[model samples]
Target: MHRAERPVLEVADIFRVHGPAWRQTVQLSLGQLKVMSAIEQCRSAALGGHVLRCSGCSRTEIAYNSCRNRHCPKCQASAAHRWLEARQADLLPGEYYHVVFTLPAVISAIAWYNKAVLYGLLFDIAADTLRTIAADPRHLGAQIGATLVLHTWGSALTHHPHVHGIVSGGGLTSDGERWVACRPGFFLPVRVLSRPFRRRFLEELAALHRRGQLRFFGEYAALADPAVFARWLAPLRVCEWVVYAKRPFAGPEAVLAYLSRYTHRVAISNQRLVALDERGVTFRWKDYRAKGRTRYKTMTLGADEFMRRFLLHVLPSGFHRIRHYGLLANPVRRHNLAKIRGLLHATATGAQAAAANAPPGNLPPRFICRHCGAPMVIIDILQRSAPIRAPPAQRAAA
Candidate 1:
């Protein structure tokens, strides 16, 4: 389902009314307001952009430029292409894995208030846990690279903060000699990873508390006290933290396909939106837990309630949603990727190398104007504005 369209349809009324009141409200943060404005004006003429016309038939087509913000649904296709291009050269000749590290509702509550700190903590703990475990002699005994993305919402647009990790199946040995691979069907012990992640996260939280770095208010006020913080963490120690690992992908191609679909996905899509009537907003969502989960279900929610749920996922300013760790670390990524490729090339060749190094395939051609059959150019861009006016006609000789 194209969940990206839901917001544009559902929030039409809210944009019509409270859109001007943005300057007055403090609870509605700048990020939220910016998203609201984008939702209202996206695909409309309020922001100048472009329009297309067919030369042969003289049929004018209206098209708008996307904000291209990572959070914007319409912009993700191009974003995914660019990201895949950058990573093409870095692909290793081996299996890849999809791992997810989820924060419990308890921590999610605190994260709602202190997003920057807590979200950073979540990434650090998850990455550090994987790195530490992989380096252990009992495990893979190699340093790995992981691409981590932070997602704060679930399929139904609920607040469920989690980090999704796309990890290269193997890694270079500590001395950068050989590419070490993992056993089939297993990556790391989930129990071990969960325990360490929980411990490391709590340790950092404790440090933040001692340094007076964490702000506690609303339901999280009790965490301000040291004793209360300890008690809050105690329950978490015994409960099993979920660290899900899907079966390894065939190679980097499969991994990139998964990333293209999952990465940059917003809470909802435009196509899934059915209507925005007095019954509130209606949209479709997937039930991931159910078998044959391909079926989509419709949900109706009040406008105010829908807005609240949507705003819950707006991140703090300048916060990065995607991050890299270990060999994929920014400073040494190019050098490390080159070395890794050299090693992989020594072992593998032909189709594998071509797949790893080649650029993504071309996009299909667009429809041409019927009259002149000339490729039309976008003349003006419009977002949520009045219907486009017809282009002026040229009179033929009688």
Candidate 2:
């Protein structure tokens, strides 16, 4: 006989249990609290839902609606799927490179206090670094396109701010009449990319400081002084900044697959939660320093600490986490892509052709029956349940 599978543990479960007690103990921003509330109520009656019946088997079930909060781990999968579907038409028939620009620990600490300004600089500078370097005569010397995604958390849910860029292998010539491609398997040198990225970022950061745009709090409050801030930045100038470029993707499909993993990732996933109990919240994390099988490890953090780390990555409201630059910039993207295809003598791929032939506004149905493999039709609309005014009392004594 087959053994029954255990149900998965989710972040929402932890929030529902411990959040009230934790909230009384520490301060949280409006945005962070909103994220917590959204996670706690996601896909539950709190958000309302619909009743579905299978066309084939007559099976019926109540399907609660997702919170649709971008930061919610449970909500990003469908968001990523929809995003990838839209991006399919933009795929070019060439190599694509994955480049990452990571901020050092010192900067990350400051970023925690001044998120909007600092994180915005990170995105703008990283994209500029790629476009500027790629435009050089010694480098590719072409105007390329890129899609950059900002991920603020490490595997252990630590605040590790970085931008992952998916860049096309080639670009249009100066006159916009020809196509230029990079050498196979190689993009730009990381060492070359790193120095400018560091310099440009620091310069812009200093400018922000001079303009009094950056903020500070707690132990970092001394950074409000220009002299103290200058001294703090001194060490970072000499330290090496990290700019990493992975090998070119095998094909467009591989690029999309890789993007699916990175683009919509949250601080933690539901699958990684191994246990939650008196000891704390236990989860699996990857140690990049370890080799082979040893790299994977499980870690436990006290419920309060775990919630602190999770909330550390809550972004400012209305910040765009994913961005485009150069030829892929939204305004000129379509025109530039048409020009590049013509120069390369390239025809639309089968996927692109199908996308074009598809009827306008024709979207696939979302819900389906698991048992009967048929479309799930909505039979009843369920109004949202009243919001929980307070998280339940702590379950520590249980």
Candidate 3:
């Protein structure tokens, strides 16, 4: 039986080849080390797998298991599919808006050192900003639901912290009596959202500092002083915080398509990597500042530098990257959805509602024959193999 070809290159390959040497030059946290190890072993014999035989041609092969680490670039596709299936029921027939709130570079630098506190604040404050603006009489003037996702890397893997929010275009009235819709193709104004978002975030950030919840290091070590911290924040108060809303989605289907791409993304995907060699790791990146064709381009970075940039986004241990707020909050989501559906005259339940909103596509089965295009069935299970040990030199450095 013929086995399928693996990608010419993957993050896993880079990690296995260069990670040991890189670990020697820098201090990595336990969590970071674990992530590197996971990527290196994913979908290899080290994890063990199962024997599968094709029903059509009697061809057999071994299928290894994935590491399933949330941070692994190799594993997010299936994760995203499963997540989208659950979210099908949450879709509303009304228009949906995509909103992004970004912290300036100055704040992002400190955020690198205080991810849990600062990132958590980013999610909470961004959600609060949307609800506050939507509830204002001048805006949509209702209680809207939103799903917010935090992304810490830019196209080039820089430490750019931002939250992408998917908000229902309208909301239920303050008394929960009826549905209210915003003007066609329009959501809340970005200028209005920016001011309050900026104010509340800085206010909350100062509070965290006052309580000694934030950390500073190296060049920023002076920020530990309360007076020094205030001075550092002075410029941020006057700066225009980046908050913008894209046009309303084409329909519920479009929103699902968007969610599928964004919800489970890593710092980089295997598909984007073009090559790896003595020159460096080459990959595609978009330059948002440029217009048209000029926006798309490739970048090359030394393998060591690439790995460092990728690990910068590992996240604090157990931090939740995706969150729901306002009407979409988990505890009340089902009840709130049922009520909204009633108002919209589409009060279907369970399988019926999910069917109506589900995106059109058939997810492939877990195993398929590489030779004859037939489904494969497992014939035997293989237990995990013994763990591999690092070289003595590498062990000492790590």
Candidate with top lDDT is 3
**Candidate 3 CA-lDDT value:** 0.90
TM-score of each predicted structure versus truth: 0.83, 0.95, 0.92
> Tens digit of lDDT per residue, candidate 2, span 1-398?
11123238999999999997899988788788889999999888988999988888999888888888888988888888878877887888889999999999989998999898989999999999988999898999989999999999999999999999999999887889888899999999999999999999999999999999998888999999999999999998999999999999999999999989988889998889999999999999999989999999999999999999999998899988989899999999878887888888888788776665678678766677778678888999999985633344458875
Q: Give per-residue CA lDDT, model 1, range 1-398, as digits (tens).
A: 11132244534355555445543443676677677766665555665555776545666865555555555556676677667756666667778888899998888888888899999999989999999999998999999999999999987889899999988888889899998888876788888888898888878888888999988897688889989988888888788788888899877778878888777777766666777778877888887776675556788987667667877887887998899999999998878877887887754345445545566674322435545666665665454443222222448999
User: Comparing 1 and 3 by lDDT, which wins?
Assistant: 3
C-alpha root-mean-square deviation, candidate 2: 4.4
Assess candidate 2 and give its TM-score to the true structure: 0.95
Query: Which residue pairs clash within candidate 2?
Result: none
Assess each prediction's global lDDT (C-alpha) against the native: 0.75, 0.89, 0.90
Q: What's the residue-level lDDT of 269 in candidate 1?
A: 60
Which candidate would rank higher by TM-score, 2 or 3? 2
Clashes of 1: 28
Clashes found in each candidate (C-alpha, N, C closer than 3 A):
28, 0, 0
